[model samples]
Target: MTAIPLSWWVSVATALFVIGLYATLTRKNAIAVLIGLELMLNSANINFVAFNRYTTPNQVGGQIFAVFVIAIAAAEAAVALAIIIATYRRSATVDVEDIDSMKF
Candidate 1:
């Protein structure tokens, strides 16, 4: 079997990150932004694994870091969703631009 080069993985990660960036920028809904954030996190995780696999096969540092990122992402998602829900409850809409009650 032919081995895939590191550039391939890096390219994929870069593309995913860019897609996520676009989604985050263009989407107005809070949930859509959350999805974009997830995509970006996943892209970073992919890069971490790819580097670990190519650089140091024996050590599991990359995998460990990815796990930590996953944990942080989960927490962040929960907190963000809770805040979004609270905002929706107050403002009646999930649009990030529409919910501007916080502005003083």
Candidate 2:
């Protein structure tokens, strides 16, 4: 069996990042934006693991960093969802453009 190249991993990560960025910038729905953010975070995790695997096979720094990123992503998702839900309750919609103010 042959091991995959680092460049391949990088290419995949780049694609994921690009798609995520596009979704984030083009989507008008809060849920879609959140999904894009998650995709970006996942791509970062992939890069971290790939670099660690290629540079320091014996060390786990990359995996550890990826784990931290996952934790942070979870926290961010929870907080963001809470905010979105609150906003929806107030405005009856999740469209980004429709949410123009912070006033309740």
Candidate 3:
């Protein structure tokens, strides 16, 4: 059976990563940063799965690593969300710039 080209998958992943990077860098909200981080993690997973499936159709190593990455991403999201909620409660806002505590 024929499959989609590897380059296509790589391009998709690259696009996702770039979008995520842009969101993380440009957004002032903590929740938006977390969403961007999730996008980046998902992009990496796509690369892992695409390479593993295309390059080593006989082995499942890539899938396994991708699963691990997913688990880590989930945990990271949970922790990050908890922190954001706490910060929002304390400051009444989620803006990263307004939450700065080191201001003299």
Judging by TM-score against the true structure, name the best candidate: 1
TM-score-based ranking, best first? 1, 2, 3
Give TM-scores for every candidate, taking all chains together and pairing residue i with residue i.
0.95, 0.94, 0.94
On lDDT, the leading prediction is 2
RMSD of each: 1.2, 2.0, 1.3
* Residue 82 lDDT (model 1): 99
> For candidate 3, which ten residues in a row score worst on lDDT?
1-10
- Could you give me the TM-score of model 3 versus the true structure? 0.94
Q: List the residue pairs that clash in candidate 2.
A: none
Candidate 3, position 39, lDDT:
96
lDDT of each: 0.94, 0.94, 0.93
Candidate 1 stretches greater than 4 Å from native: none
The superposed Cα distance between candidate 2 and the true structure at residue 56, in angstroms, equals 0.4
lDDT of 2 at 28: 98
Model 2 lDDT at residue 51 = 94
- Error of model 1, residue 58, in angstroms: 0.8
Which 10 consecutive residues of model 1 have the lowest summed lDDT? 1-10
